[model samples]
Target: MTEDQSALKTLSEVVRDRRLQLGLSTRALAQRCIDPGTGKAIPRHYIQRLEDDLANLAPPRLPELSALAAGLELPLAVIQEAAGFQFHGVTTRHSESGRARMFVARFDELDPAEQDRVLAMLEAYTAVKPPKVD
Candidate 1:
């Protein structure tokens, strides 16, 4: 990443890591990332540019984002949110873990009783002793 990239999980990092984790090359990823809007494969160079953190590149639209998410075998919301935070400066109450982040992101939209129930369940989970690590 460039010197200016934030420490938070970024679109660039997610794309690169997921691609590598799946043993896909840029060309393979591009072949999978077919833009639904145009039914055309996203160019390999575009995928490379995204992984390279090319400055001033616009945040991908929903179609590219959706294709990328599928190409990486990840949820669209996760990729979309990461892209927003990385490229658009979207403010979020950062969580150390992705599960916590997902919960926090949607928690505010829940009804009061629903939120209370979720918190209660969470408390119960925490109250149980975790298995001892060797």
Candidate 2:
């Protein structure tokens, strides 16, 4: 596969991983996308296609992303990261143990719950911590 295709694959994997982590089935996520104002829903098959990487839906509109993040009860940054597009100024580092360490070294982008989840996962997976000094 070409570099772009490889990147897209990585992006797709990220989304799938995060979606699973959030405990959302594709159909449930699709239902969450219903347009409140118009009472219309984006089709479940379309969502399945997107998650399965059979189709690359374009970057979601702001409102759509917002509603999705809200429904998933996750920060937009988390969704965006899973979607493989980081917002400006977010940096990520991977520890020696292979745990992803994200540094929002700019703004306090993630809410407390998201932070807790991330930290808990990191601790569970890698037991990461600063080395003790003499």
Candidate 3:
């Protein structure tokens, strides 16, 4: 396979790994995409093709990726990374201290309303730092 195809295969593997880690069957995941207005389920075959890497679904369309991320309760960035795309703005530091400080600073940089929304989201999804004791 060409490099691009290999990369796509790796990305597909990542998606499959994440899906399995989340314990979602292809059919179950498709059901999560049910259209609210129509109440029609997304076809299971579409999901199966995606998981099997049999379809050209790598670099999945944004709306579908967003739905899968929501259904998996995963951060969009994590999903994007799994899909072989890196988010540009988020910084990654080598040291844990630097990482923590950067995270806090990034957290602070948001507007107050956005900060509240982000904090609420973080609380709902993953563990956050407790207030410093000392």
Candidate 4:
């Protein structure tokens, strides 16, 4: 198969798998893909078509893909990669464990009181952050 066709198949499979892994229905997933700027959810039919591999539907635009990433709790790079874009820099992206290790390096250096403050600040941030679309 051609590269683009292979990528399209990959994207289709990934989206379906991620949605199922997250226990989301197509309608729910579509709701999560709402345009932040326009406040419009991606058409549920379109998501279904993509997942079902119906012909003639366009590849999702960057914004829609980004929304899907946020909704699916996946890194944007994963979706981008499945869409056939090769990243040139950094050889590979850092894993979640690597990110945690980096975070600990700085967090561990802080004093106890500072650590407590930071934890409290993070808690506040979490409380105020927008709720994920259900």
Best by lDDT: 1
The lDDT for every candidate, in the order shown, is 0.81, 0.56, 0.58, 0.68
TM-score of each: 0.62, 0.43, 0.46, 0.53
Tell me how far the alpha carbon of residue 36 in candidate 3 is from the true structure, in angstroms, after superposition.
10
For candidate 2, lDDT tens digit of each residue in 1-134?
Answer: 44434343233465466568879887777777654445556667766666666543665554555545555666655555545542232334446664334354212356678888877887886876668799
Highest TM-score, which number?
A: 1
By TM-score rank, best first, the candidates go 1, 4, 3, 2
As for candidate 2, its clashing pairs are none
Worst 10 residues of 4 by lDDT: 85-94
For model 2, what is the error of residue 101's alpha carbon versus the real structure, in angstroms, after optimal superposition?
13
Count of clashing pairs, candidate 2: 0
What's the ranking of the predictions by lDDT, best on top? 1, 4, 3, 2
lDDT of 1 by residue, 59-105 (tens): 89878887897788887767877798779976455466668777775
Candidate 4 ranges beyond 4 A from true positions: 1-9, 36-40, 85-134
Checking candidate 4 for backbone clashes, the offending pairs are: none
Query: How displaced is residue 39 in candidate 2, in Å?
Result: 7.1
Task: Give the 10-residue window scoring lowest on summed lDDT in candidate 3.
Answer: 85-94
- Compare candidates 1 and 4 on TM-score and give the better one: 1
Q: What TM-score does prediction 4 earn?
A: 0.53
